[model samples]
Target: MKPIRALSNADEVVRLLGSEGDMSPAEIAERLDIPRPSVYRLLDGLESIGLTESVPGSRARLNLRWLHLADQARESMVEWAGARELLSELVERTSQTAYLTVLRGHEAVCLEWEQGRAVGVLLLKPGRSLPLYAGAAGRTCLAFGVNVEEYLDTVTERRAYTADTLTSDAALRADVEATRRRGYVFSDEDVTDGIAAIGVPIRGSRGQLLGALSVSGIKVEYLAKRDAYLEALLDVAGRLASLNEAAIQ
Candidate 1:
C-alpha cells in the first residue's frame, strides 16, 4: 500500500476535529480511512505545535489556538462587526431566521445568522454555503455580485436541490432579470421543502456590492408576510449600507 502524505493527513485531521469535535486516535483513523499509527503521529505533531490537545477519555480536540485564529478571521470582516446586533434585531422584528451572506467564488457563504422561534431547521448557517443558483441568498449574489456572462460560462453543472430548484440556464437568466428588476429574491421551496426565503442585496455607501441579507421561515407564513418582511429587510440593509467604511475599520 502507498504511504499517506503526512501534510495532507495532518490537515484532514484538523478539519475533522473542527467539524466532529473531540475524537480518539482510533476514531480519527477510522473516519479518515488511514492507519491508527498514522493518526497518532498526526495528533502528536499537532499537539506539539499547540494546535490540538488531549482531552479526558483519550480524546483529542482542537485547542485555544483555533479560537485565536477564529477571532482574527472575525476581526478581518469589519463590515460585519455590528452584524450580530443587527441580525438579532431583524429576528426580533420578523420572528424568523436571519442570515448574512457574502459571495465567495461561485458560492454564497453564510457569515452569520440568528435563529428565531418560528423556524428551527435551517439549510444555511455560519460556516455553511450554497451554490449560487440554489437559494435566495445565492441567487441574490448571482444577480448582483458578479459578471453574469462570466459566471454562466464557469458553471459546469447545476445540481437540483429540491423539486422546485431552477437548474436550467434559461430559468436562472430569467430569475436574475427578475431579481434585478425587483431588488429582492422570493425563494419558494427551491432549497428545502416547506421553507422559503427573501434575500436582498446590501451595498456599501458607494453602491458597491457588500453582501446579502436574508430571512427564512415556513413557506406559508413567509408568503403571507412577504411585504412586511421585505420592508424590514430593506430598512436594515439601508442602515448597513450607511455604515462608514473608515468608522468600521
Candidate 2:
C-alpha cells in the first residue's frame, strides 16, 4: 500500500464524499482509487475534525457542523446588516415587492425580502430558491461580471419554468451579454404570467458579485410605466451596492 499524506488524503476523501454523498470506507476507496485501509484511516481523521460522522451500520455522512461555520463566515460580512436596511428602504420606496439574493450552487436564494403595498404581488420569503436561468434575480446574477458561457453550460440540463424562459443556449447567452452591457435585467411574463420583474446586480467592496436586488409587480402595471420602474430599480441597486461596500469596510 502507498503511504498517504495527510492533506492530500483528507482532500481526496472530502471530494469523494461531496460528489458521491455518504459511503462506506470500501466504497470511498474504490471511487478514489486508494487503498481500503488508507481510506478508513482518512475517515477516522475526518471524523475527529468534526467534518464527517459515521453511522454504526450505515455509510458515513458529512457532519454539517462546518455548515454552521460557513453561515457564521457569511454573517461576518460587514455589509449584511446595512444591506438588509437598504432592502427595506427600497421596498418602502417602490411599494412593490423587493428582495436581496445570493447565488447558491446552480440556484439563487433570497436572503432578504420585503412586501410592499401592492395587493397581489408575490411575496418572496428568505430562503426561497430559484433556478439560475428562470427569474430576474437569477438572470442578473448569471449576467453580472461572470462567465456567461460557463454558467450556461452548467445550467443547460435544468428545465425552464415558463415558455418565455430563455432556455436556448444562444438566446440565454445573448440575454446575458445584453444584461452585462445594460447593467440590469428585466423579465416580463417569463417566470410567471401576469408578473414582471426588473433586477440589478449588487457588488461588494472588492467588486465581488454580491447578488441582486429586484422589484416585481403585475405585468400590466409594470409595462405601462416600464422606463420609470427601470430607473427606480437601478437607483435602488446602486444604493444597495454602495451600502454593502460601506458596511463591509
Candidate 3:
C-alpha cells in the first residue's frame, strides 16, 4: 500500500525537528523536499496538538508533550520494574557501563543503563539508539530476535563508524552467526574507537527474545575482564527474565 502524502510529510516534519533541533518551516521544507506551504500546514497541525511549539526566530521544536508521553511509555514497561538494580549490579561486578536495549523496528533502543567506574564515551545511554549492525547490544538483539533474514533485507545501508565496524553484509551475517554460536557478542571497537562491549540476549520464560544486556568500556579493560563480564551479563539476564515471567504469572 502507498503511504498518505500528508501524513508521510508530517511524520518527516516531526522526525526532522527531533533530529535537527528547532527549525523554520522553510528549512524543514528544504530539508525534507516538501513544499513550504505544506510544511506550514504540518507545523500548524503539530502545534495545535501541542506536539510542537514555536520558539524565537519563527522556529518550531518538539514540546514538553513528548516528555509526558515518554514518562507514560516508561511506566508501561512493568516487566522492567527492577531492571535498574540489575543493571547496577552488573556495573558493580564488571566495573563497566551496563545497558539494557530492546529491538524496536530496525533499531535497538536503549531502555536503561547504569554508569560504571570505567565508563568511557558510552553511546548506549537511555533513550538513544543504534542500528542493529553496530553495537554489542544491537548485534546481540539482532542475532537473537525473530525474522533475522527479513530484518537484513530492510537494511540498505551498513555504515561503518570505525575501522573495526562491520559494513559488509557478509561480515554482519558472520557476526550474527558467531553471536548465536557463542550466545554472546564481543564487540571490539565496532561503534566507536577505543570502546569495546560484550552483549548477551535476554529471553522470557517462553524463550521469546525480550531484549539485550550489554557492558561496555575501554578496550583493554573490557577484553581483560571479558569472561567475567559475560558471566555477569548472563546471570543478570537470567534473573531479569525470571522477574518478567513471575510478573506475568
Give the candidate number with the greatest lDDT.
Answer: 1
lDDT of 3 by residue, 8-46 (tens): 888889888877899998899889999899889889988
TM-score-wise, the better of 2 and 3 is 3
For model 1 the local lDDT of residue 97 reads 93
Candidate 2 structure lDDT: 0.77
Model 3 scores a C-alpha lDDT of: 0.87
lDDT tens readout by residue for model 2, 1-249: 334466787888886786577898888888878888878878888899899999877588788886787567657765666666776777676777888888877778887777877845553556566777877898887887457778777766867667788888888888888988887788877788778888888777677787788888887777777677677777877787777677756
Please state the error at residue 142 of candidate 1 in Å: 0.8
| Rank by lDDT (best first) | 1, 3, 2
lDDT of each: 0.89, 0.77, 0.87
Model 1 lDDT tens row, 1-249? 234578888999998998789999999999999899989988998999999999999999999998787778867887677888888999999999999999999999998899987967567988778889989899999999988778888895988989999888789899999999999999999999999999999988666778999999999998689999999999988776665254465
Better of 1 and 2 by lDDT: 1
Error of 3 at 99 (Å): 1.1
Q: Which pairs in model 1 have colliding backbones?
A: none
In candidate 2 the C-alpha lDDT for residue 166 amounts to 81
> Residue 204 of model 2: what lDDT?
70
- Model 2 spans with C-alpha error above 4 angstroms: 1-77, 120-123, 205-207
RMSD of each: 4.3, 6.2, 2.0
Regarding lDDT, does 1 or 3 come out ahead? 1
